[model samples]
Target: MRVLFILILLANLGVYALGQGWLGMRPEDEGRDTRRFTQELNPGAVTLTPRPAP
Candidate 1:
């Protein structure tokens, strides 16, 4: 159906937009420290405080 095709096209476009950051998708490791840490981050760390806010 035409409606289904349009929906699928829109969904694909949304995925492309997200992948390209047009939808504001953030990298999970964007602000992570590039230097090696002596220990791994605890799973229970509050707000994922690895190094510091960028």
Candidate 2:
């Protein structure tokens, strides 16, 4: 039972390490591209108009 507990503890630690990017695996490197959202086509063309009264 002690060995099983140790194994479980080690597994949890490994998962935590990977999640924290300590294992050289970054979240941004895994197909999470943010370029499209950051690069807007026209910044000056956007205008917010007030809603018409009912």
Estimate candidate 1's alpha-carbon lDDT, on a 0 to 1 scale. 0.74
- For candidate 1, the per-residue lDDT at 42 reads 77
lDDT of 1 by residue, 1-54 (tens): 999999999999988887777766446546767565656677566564478778
**Model 2: which residue pairs collide?**
none
Q: Against the true structure, candidate 2 has what lDDT? A: 0.87
> With candidate 1 superimposed using the best TM-score fit, by how many Å does residue 50's alpha carbon deviate from the native?
39
TM-score of candidate 2 on Cα atoms, chains taken together: 0.53
Per-residue lDDT over 1-54 for candidate 2, one digit per residue giving the tens place of the 0 to 100 score: 999999999999998888888998666567767577789899899999999999
For model 2, the stretches where C-alpha displacement exceeds 4 angstroms are: 27-29, 33-54
